[model samples]
Target: MTLYEVTGREMYLKQAADLANLCATWVVSFPYLLPPETPLARLGANLTGAVWASTQNKHGAPGFCTQSGDALFKLFRTTGRAEYAELLRDVIHAHAEGIQPNGKITERLTYCDADSRGSRGDGGKTGWNETNGALMALEIPGIYIRTDRSGMFVFDHVEASIVRQDRRKMVLKITNPTRFDATVTILAEDARKAARPLGENAHLHWKEKVMVKAGQSIFHTIQK
Candidate 1:
């Protein structure tokens, strides 16, 4: 998508979209029922969006290993495809399921019996998990709405709503229930803005950041 934006080339956009769709297939589309008394099952994890590591590994995991899948969101915006957005949402939400309160996660969120199947091995946090979780929170918008009122999408583990709105502006109320402080990205654009090709690192210019302390609420007002 960035290539397409930079060079005004249709090929790059098509290639990006195709690659994104392929990546979507690696994400689990349905929940798996784990054996009773397992750590994951005891926590009531759904595992609907766990990502498969690779054919060689034969195991599923919380999110992408090294990076957050924010490209999926950019693809959705550029292509206007709802499925891409939904895919990213599922992955991020599922990633949260494996996280412990101290910001640690085991890489073993799988049903394969290769290494004690249902157990989250050794109870250690991988560097990739920590990096990806932070990347997802910082890069993807917690709540996004088209300024023309065409659509709305939420991707974070937070609560948000348009508390008030008028012809000139809209007020959004966002609440974070987690114990950790959250910096949420908010992107609101009209049809014209959405239709334009995004430049490299364009998100920095188009997004608004709101810092909500843990277990607190914040209101952001956007001009239409």
Candidate 2:
């Protein structure tokens, strides 16, 4: 088993990419909950593990590991891919349950520790915080776990604002580059259909119901 020594500064994408690449090298490093032929899924799992490693400490809760989760959430927002969200959820749940009776996040579940237990937490030589990292990782998944309903968090990147916001109404000016009518579903999470959970292939599409000029951008509204 390979262990991840993480500091707080590095974000989730860096951690995910590193872990995913590591998973490519070591197949047995973490749990293989992902299916085959899925590079993204594999990377998601490895990223989760990296988050777990950064948070686990001698106390068994977490030291300082938050960026990995952020990275996963960023992926979820940018790609609108539920697989990343789901993987992050699984990782959060595992740690939430894996803590020891004394609230220690030891390696009983996985052999990631290198047996270098000392000033854990912010005081350790590695200077990593796995606990905080693990805890916050679930925020994104928890917010967006519901596809039919409003996700916990929503982001509008086109506005050049990285800030989080509750978009009561959103207009996606979608332009159809091809000719003819293109039939598709615009996956705007409407709380009216709470039962509709977003699966792996959920994407928002813009189509013209009435007269639509070719290569014109359409508008879509969403309330979270």
Candidate 3:
């Protein structure tokens, strides 16, 4: 499973065009591989329904989990499939609905309405570990998004936008998506000059790191 996550995330990090094509094929073939016998077939139908529904085309549950969402995000990043991202976001929000004030999430999730209440064994605990793993490589809007044409590579979870992306410079509108202050290490390249981090104290150089406060968005720019 770890390898699957890594490969999915790497598809974005490396921005390999071939890998993007491969990921698209994988998603297309996923439905056919399910067996018609047993409960697995029903679960497969639910998942496909949820994916299709998320796109407003009309649509799964207990199959909803942080790990599953993470995989979907990777697929979205790899293939630029809006549906994949939508489904994953839907799952994340639904899973969040079941979270307790103490931060533990219930084990099962219903794909219909983001409900997080159920007892599917494991004593109602299932999200902490997978959530951490998912967010560690969460994809956000930026120039580094995989494409047939190449520009840059990005790997990290930060709610931000790319204000500019030219050959000489790359400017990012960055925000810390987490509740607490964080030091985000954006695995990137083309950093030879100083970084302009508006209202933030961190510098973003080539392959360097930056820091941001909880709920604060900063304009971070670096020259090549």
Candidate 4:
């Protein structure tokens, strides 16, 4: 079920209004759950083992051994969920500990030797699950740390960072992480002074909204 529906059901089941309020708080606290197309649901969903037994030998689809970790890490970072972040770390660590000198996770989940012991059907070495395990393990942590700390509410086709935030003074370092050049708008609250680009001499008249281009980075400071 979608998170909104699930939360709504929970709200209906709650006998007390205070408990219902807690559900609302949870929604605000974890925005990642609002997306219906979350990574875990996208990358990890699968049919029973019978559909994948020809290769994976276990229930669920193959080719996602370590990808799930990346999915979960993104979710954790987006939502600031401690449990999901920790689970992402645990999954990555398990793969790391099982990696051989050649950098492949040990085939057997229960295998304790230093050698890689798992089997990956006939798909060869370039399959999705082959090298992505290590790559995802290496890439997820840094992204997690950066995204978790960012307070900016990024919308579609945008990436941003809150360089500094205060009641009277706000500093933002906004970026368009996408490839194509496009216009993007940023919102500021109680901005009283003209917005100025940091590390440069450019400045805009005091405005609550700022627009930037794709792949552009701007440092802005405004007074409340």
Candidate 5:
């Protein structure tokens, strides 16, 4: 399960996008505007404003998270807004058709609606463990990845092999794509159920303040 499955905050990213737009816009005229979260706002109001505009047409007018959900995640985390979290989950799910084992989130990236009745194909299924899919790589103890963190793996294409050695010891092996090589940090607390209810052991990967190495494989061991 991805981050959306755990909290469903992304479900409301659209709404958050709308709100963030208003918030960011309203603050633009300020003598000294508060800096927004990274990759976007951290870039400045102009960049954040561009993100808002992109959110409006993300995946061409709603139903996408790569742009909006990311924006909302930053907003919600910064402002502690519930609406941002809700829209965050929705926007993420909008693009992500469904979550698969190994953190492969099959995304339409250009869907018409939630049920994915009429959707456009933009090759969202390329299987990239960037942002939304990296949720599966940290399924082991002491493993976690923060998608928005600079210099970290994307979390969409990373696949992890969770091996239980003896009783309390576990080994997590991660495979990444060659496109980007950032050190992704995967953390875990305990095994829990998934948000969307998947057949293959859908477990949530814990996250921490770390990053993933690009195209490189790494392992971490946890002892109970």
Candidate 6:
């Protein structure tokens, strides 16, 4: 997508979309029912969006090893495909499940027979997992809404609602329940805006950032 934006080449966009679909194959589409005694099961963790490492490793993890996977979001915006958005949403939410109160996480969110299966692993504070999670939060919008279709999609751990709406504006109430502070991204678009071609760094223009302290709520109003 960036390549397309930079070079105005149709080939680049097609290649990026194809690559995003290929990456989707590695993501677990269904939640596995783990052994009742497993730590993940006891904690009610869902592995729906966990990405498998490889055929040999046979283990699934919260997000990408070292990248945010924001390319999927860019593809969604460019193609107007809900599947791309939904795939990233699942991964983002799954990443939250393994996070500790202090924002630490282990890469092992597995369902395979590996030694670390259904466990967070003893690898304590896997920096890659933390990096991916933070990158997703920073790059992806917490909530996206399309005014023309009355569509809303959430991709963060925070709670959100459309508290007020009229012809001129829409108001949102977002709450953060985690131990750490959150910077929620809100992206809203009308039909004309949504139909426009996305350029490099287009998200920065459409997204609004709201800072919510832990266990607090804030109201954001967006003009139509």
Clashes of each: 0, 17, 5, 2, 45, 0
The 10 consecutive residues of candidate 1 with the worst lDDT sum are 198-207
Ten residues in sequence with the least summed lDDT for candidate 3: 193-202
lDDT of each: 0.81, 0.36, 0.41, 0.36, 0.37, 0.82
lDDT, candidate 2, at 143: 27
Best by lDDT: 6
Error of 5 at 208 (Å): 4.3
Off by over 4 Å in 1: 175-181, 199-207, 211-219
> What TM-score does model 6 achieve against the real structure?
0.83
User: What is the per-residue lDDT of model 2 for residues 1-224, given as tens digits with 9 covering 90 to 100?
Assistant: 01111322336445655554442232222453434334323233232332333334412222124333444444455445565555455444444333333444443233234343221222222213344433453223222323343343322111111123344543334345534343323333444443232323132222322223455545544344
Could you say which candidate leads in TM-score?
Answer: 1
Worst 10 residues of 4 by lDDT: 194-203
Candidate 6, 1-224: lDDT as tens digits: 77876777889989998898898889989878899898889888888899888758768888998877888887887778899998998898888778765658988887898676788664478789989887886677788888766677788878888898888888888889978798777888887886565554555674578899999998989777
Tell me each candidate's TM-score.
Answer: 0.85, 0.33, 0.43, 0.31, 0.30, 0.83
Those runs of model 2 whose alpha carbons end farther than 4 Å from true positions after fitting are: 1-68, 111-130, 133-141, 145-224
Model 3 stretches with alpha carbons more than 4 Å out: 1-71, 108-124, 127-158, 177-179, 182-209, 222-224
Instruction: Write out the backbone clash pairs for model 6.
Output: none
Candidate 4 per-residue lDDT, tens place, 184-208, comes to 3343322121111111111132124
| Candidate 5 C-alpha error for residue 109, in Å | 6.0
lDDT of 1 by residue, 125-145 (tens): 788887888788767788888
Q: In candidate 5, which residue ranges exceed 4 Å CA deviation? A: 1-155, 191-211
Question: What TM-score, to 2 decimals, does candidate 5 have?
Answer: 0.30
**RMSD of model 6 against the true structure:** 2.8
lDDT of 4 at 84: 51
Q: Once model 2 is optimally superposed onto the true structure by TM-score, how far is the C-alpha of residue 150 displaced, in angstroms?
A: 7.7
